[model samples]
Target: MTDWAHHRFTANDLLLDRQLVDSRGMMAGRIDDLELSDPEPDPAGGGSAARAPVLTALLCGPIAYGPRLGGRLGTWWAATGRRLRGDGDGYPCRIPLSLVARVDRMQVRLTSPRELLPSYRLRAWVADKVIAPLPGSGR
Candidate 1:
């Protein structure tokens, strides 16, 4: 694996709210939150571990975005997403860090296709149940 520790970009400046594009150049979603792994203890006898807390996944969806917004409305928005999901777990969609191909000033590009992402569940649901049923939606 390439050593991401050597990379100099700040996560907050480069990743937060950046658009995520799949390998097919399809828009998946904006990065709403980053999931970092806890530092693991080193087995080589030093007090410090070889790996520190590292970015593990990208979280996308209202559940992730709402906490960042931090207000009553944000809470409501997140709750609505949870209700729609009906999973009782309320966790936001997580895209593994391994799928990230590159990060630029405007967006983060993925190594996977957009259709494989869990983040598109709501959009797909709406399209199938609502948009597809419209009179002129080309059904």
Candidate 2:
């Protein structure tokens, strides 16, 4: 697994709610949660049987955001997202760790281009259906 120990920052303090940006510098979304790989045996045979968890992916979308928000409003938000997706998968969009370039004070930059991300589904739909048909909207 890739070692991120060199980076000194807590996930909750530095990552959560931070904006995600693609390689082309387009705003993708905000990070709601971090997906960590299951703990594995320490190769170095440390005192503890399990090593520290490895960062695997970043979770985005309403499905992820809802639970963090909590209460009835959170449930409704997640339900609305599920309805819009129209798919059996209720999980949030997961961006792999490999695609992440760097995490700064403000945003997490991705190695992949924006067009390749599934996170743009809602934005694309809104642009095509709601914004494109407006009177003065540039088609």
Candidate 3:
């Protein structure tokens, strides 16, 4: 494994948009934001072990994603988002840190498929309402 210091990503580079994937290799969504935690020092010989930062969880979909992109648009987006679910849990999708299997290039591999999650409502809605209205919707 290459040392993180030698890796290509700068601090700003890490904050940009990226896609999130699942273990079955399905497209989960985009990496809207990162969840960070303080590092725990290893007690063994009082030395630091080599490891990438823990992933924690992945945030995705429009409602969850929009707020991360904060501003006027973000506020309107989040407000409209809440109305969609009608008091359903208005949470951005969260995938546990343990689910990640690998991180390569700009994509994350997970240990389970997206179907395992309950946040596919947006995907279904788009397909049913918007896309279904377009020409050759079934195709």
TM-score of 1: 0.82
Residue 95 CA displacement from its true place in model 1, Å: 0.7
lDDT, candidate 3, equals 0.64
Off by over 4 Å in 2: 1-6, 39-52
Candidate 1 lDDT at 105 equals: 76
Residue 130's C-alpha lDDT in candidate 1? 93
User: Which residue pairs in model 2 clash with each other?
Assistant: none
Off by over 4 Å in 3: 1-16, 36-55, 128-139
**Per-model TM values vs. the true structure:** 0.82, 0.82, 0.61
User: What is candidate 3's TM-score against the reference?
Assistant: 0.61
Give per-model CA RMSD: 4.2, 4.8, 6.8
Q: Write the per-residue lDDT of candidate 3 for residues 1-139, one digit (tens) a residue.
A: 2113224554345433656677677787766656654367466646445654554565665677677779999988877776776667777666666666666566766677777765567787788889998999885
- Which ten residues in a row are the worst by lDDT in model 2? 1-10
Worst 10 residues of 3 by lDDT: 1-10
Q: What's the distance in Å from true for residue 84, model 2?
A: 1.4
